[model samples]
Target chain A: MSGTINHGLAQLAAVDQGFFTDRSGGGCIQDNKLFCPGWVADNYDRYVHPTLQHLVLVGSAVAAGFLIAFALAIFAHRHRWLQTPFLAGTGILYTIPSISFFFLLLPITGRGALTAIIALTAFNLQIIFRNVTNGLRNVPANVTEAATGIGMTPSQVLWRVELPLALPEVIAGLRIATVSTVALATLAVFANGGGLGTEIVTGSNITFKTGIIVAGSIAVIMAILFDAVLLLIGKLLAPWKRKQALV
Target chain B: MIPLPALTLPTAAFGLFGDAFNFVFDGREAETGGVTVGGTSQVLDLAAKQLEVTLLALAVAILLAMPVGLWLGHRQKGEFLAVSAGNAGRAIPELALIALMAAAIGVGLVNLVVALAILGIPPILTNTYVGISQVDRASVEAARGMGMTETAIVRKVELPLAVPTIMGGVRTAAINIIATATIAPLAGILTLGDFIIARNVYGDAGVLAGAILVALMALALEGTLAGIQWAMTSKGLKLKRS
Candidate 1:
């Protein structure tokens, strides 16, 4: 029991001392290099691993959000009475500040990736759900009528006609969710879910400019990269939009 | 550090919600150095600070972005600028912007306000531009044919018509600013975030109470702004609504 307490205290001491001091035998400002490449080189595992973890956290949350929100959107669409309550609930969830959401989940999930992903997934629901419903609703009435007249079942019409027509808006929703999630996932560090935010938080705590710049730039770059890729996917998915643009 | 104990799912969930309720209703005098509570005055004080930061940032963003967006929209120019700026702003994470500002300006209220102002700008700017450009071009043309100057056409016809959309943008910006302002404590500004950031000192009760407070404040701001948005809409616009 005493040994366990000592281990906990040591960990606390290390956090207080700052990770840089504990790892590099000094502050981040050794030899006037704003960020010592040597230190980063030595600590490649720290940076690289966190970046990958950040990607996994964000990717899983977006995927989970898409599946859940899509299912909810379909259910709400079929039953008109459910739409209002469903949207209102997700809107309330989105309105809760990200920090509050994280702490609210902390006790139940503890400090880990699960907590971060769940919070992130909740945030994505409003955007994805709204867009999915809007897209399906925007499908022209005549198209659905024609599908039904051709002996298509309601389910068949949804799969063959409505979903295909709704693909543009759905993909647009995905782009928005993907970009915002990349940004919000940085908060995962506070929840003990390792991500680029870990570096930002540590840098801020220690006043390390190099650490802040490197991590901050990487996060921004990641957001832009994800956004661009999603935009490309959006264009590819909706080739008619490209043809319209050409005209 | 609290020792880990295995908890059933129901119990953990109950504890989470129940703890938050108790913190707001039954929390005792704080034994910490961060956010003090047990009295209305302390909670009110932090809420005021949070509002001040949010309002100041939002005001600055409006001052800077609104005129440019309005002019560009009136001229029907800079479509690329408006779209790209909105996209770029959305792409930059709020935390990164805050950290960058802290590094550049050093930690303080100023750093947080600057970062948050940048966050608030895009929505308002884009909305203003879209709102103005989307005004009935026929009305603008009619005003011009009636010998109204470009400025007069914009002021008398375009601006009033654009109010709903512009207000829509402001609503979005206001909510984003209010939500992001919770992070101000990290930049050495005392706000509701102090409750969560100093959880080790304030304990779970303080953290939960803080979360509840922030959530309530955000909801109140959103509700108030939505009311304003609705009130500002012209009756004609309301009648035209689906």
Candidate 2:
């Protein structure tokens, strides 16, 4: 136990201390060859791996969350006993603090990307499940009635009619969840998995390097690009709704 | 204005209560002098600051979004933009925005307010646009045909009618902003997140306390917004819903 604790402390120290102290150099515009800005640029790739890891962690969590949310929605929809308790439970889960949840599970999950992913996925499930439930529920009664009256099985009605109508909201929820998972994924850096947040943490530890600037810029660019792409996708998929809305 | 302060107080109170409760919880097992409550004051202070920041951002979003949303709604352009921009806004994670804001402005309340503004914008903007547009067209047509000016029709006919729906968006935006505002401490802001982050650094019972405090803060925001939604939509104009 002492060995494990020492190893964890040593690992944290390496990331927290080593990363900060190892800055490139200092110089003004024309006075010297190695400037902080140039150093930050030169080390861009150092950030990429952590960022990629963060992305993978988030991507996996979102994928898992969607599956769970979808299954739960279907189960809750069919099971009369599950609806209220499921909702109440998820709603409370929705309230759990991410830090508390992460720490509570840290001893078991052993920190790193796994803990972040688990916490994020669990938190995200609430929103996704709620959205799925509402999306499925909101299919016009007329359409469902027509499907049932035509003698379609329950499965056929769900796959054919309800799912299609629910697509807009479900897709919207997925988009939101994707963004959330991406953002929260950065917090994984605290667990030593590394991400843009590592840069922020490192930058704060070393006041001179402007790691903050570099990290912040990359985070902004990612967010803008992510938002723009999702907007494009939402528009393309929901052209019918968009046209109707415009009219 | 009266309603906002009245609405905000219980949240502030509960935030304090939650922080106190968490503090006791954190101190329970530890030796009397050794136990630290872990910046509960900072969290409370941050909650107040966050509430201030949220109100400021919401005020700005409401100001900008209402006019544009109302105009678009009047022009029947609410739906397209609502789906496109609102979806995109919702998709741009709050943390990403904070990081971006912190990058652009450096870390501080300014960055936090900007990040939250981004988070709070979609709901208010979408609701305003949708609410005004969703107003009964016949009512608008009849009012216009009766010689009401376009501006008057909007101010008098559309806004009042759209209030309930718009209020829904505002309520959602406020709650989202409040919840997200906690993340501000990641950037070194002295908010409730400080407690959470500090506990992360210390690994003490303070972590649980901080978490509970933050949750209660969230609940308080949730209830206040619900009340605001009720008050704004309620027909009889009662000060209290009951």
Candidate 3:
């Protein structure tokens, strides 16, 4: 695992050089192409690092969000009275604009991955919490009753029966949160968390079309990839859902 | 004791919050280009610009997306189109879209509006499609049986039934656009983002004030839409659900 991470980091270093370093020596014109291949060759690291950083921001945020949201959902499910307040609070949190959220955390976190992750985690809460509670609530009462009748504890029923039934909606929520986080993670660069947004911002500032396209495309591709992966996980976790082609 | 990151704790966060409060309430006069700029009035002006950008984008998005979404939903023919559009929308980050547009078109209000409008389309489109499609087939059939034309059935039956869901979509789009418009400054369009984006010029207080205003704007819009959604939901449907 360390070896893979090290290899990834090495590639990211290459991408970083591509992004921050000036390749003025490389001619802008080659075969009349607007984007110079020589420049790209010199700056490969620029793309790799930002892309990896973007994924790291998104992945960690989603994982943290899921844990928090899952706990909240379970708590709310057990104590129905908490449901309204929990949803309302998270709903309010959800509406806090992404960029503003980042800035709000900036003072506390001081511009880094921590602030970005915290803000991104907060953004994911409403989606994940709503979906999780909905999923748990949707688990048929009869199944739980049967489990209880068979001498299973409440925890056992929750784990074995309810959770399995709830997997589809839970995974659906995960998919949305993951995709949205991947998209939003681009803003992490504004917090100095470093992501593909840096490339786009720098590219736009300098009017570098190749940098903008490469970085923006990677961010979009990352979003799509995460969505696809979550969708696949959902399918695998709940094979029964495969019969019904609902998104 | 374990080492903790700065500002992670509530005490530290609240301290920063206090600084933000002081900045907004008591900070020195902010000047840009040798002219005083920061104050309540400036924030309000920026708020108006933010609203203008958000409203214009939403209007265009609704115009572009609603008809196609409604038509496809009514026919139940373009599920692929609706799904693909929604996915594509979700897959593109707003910042990247804004940056790409800024790069391609150069910075201006029109460019910002176009980027934001694209961001606003998918939610409205998907929600409209889902809403109309989810309307009871029996109700649609009854309208048809009563000698209602296809258009008439859609207008009188399907649309009314689908109002809440469509409104929900609109609400989502509106809020998304509002949040996204905060980044319009990067495109050289002046909005609330100007304060946050130019933190050095505006200071931490200005950034905090901008953040607060943006949050308030988003919350107000969300609450207003939620209220509208509640009001527009048919009484019969509410009763049925309860």
**Candidate that beats the other on lDDT, 1 or 2, i.e. the better one:** 1
Kindly list the per-residue Cα lDDT of model 3 for residues A90-192, writing each as its tens digit: 9988889888898887666677787888889999998999888888888888889999999999999988989888888888888888888888888877777
Residue A105, model 2: Cα distance from true site in angstroms? 4.8
* Model 2 interface RMSD, one decimal: 14.5
* Residue B235 error, candidate 3, Å: 1.3
DockQ of each two-chain model: 0.42, 0.16, 0.51
Can you give the TM-score per candidate against the true fold?
Answer: 0.86, 0.72, 0.89
Model 1 C-alpha lDDT per residue in residues A1-247, reported as the tens digit of each score? 9999999999988896776565662444554344566556545566786688889888988999999999999999899889889998888877777777887776676777877888889888988998899889989999999999999999999988998788878877887788778888887877777788898788337356566677767777888888778778878877766521100
The residue-by-residue lDDT of candidate 2 on A1-247, one tens digit each, is: 9999999999999987766455442332133221257666546777786667666776778888889988999988888578778876766555554544564444345456666677778877877887788888878899999999999999999988888777667766776677666656666554554566676565334232255555645655665566567657767766655422110
**TM-score of candidate 2 against the unseen true structure:** 0.72
Query: In model 3, what is the error at residue B6, expressed in angstroms?
Result: 3.5
Between candidates 1 and 2, name the one with more favorable DockQ: 1
Q: Best-fitting candidate, measured by DockQ?
A: 3
Chain B fold agreement for model 3, TM-score = 0.90
What shift in Å separates residue A31 of candidate 1 from its native position after superposition?
7.4
Candidate order by lDDT, decreasing, is 3, 1, 2
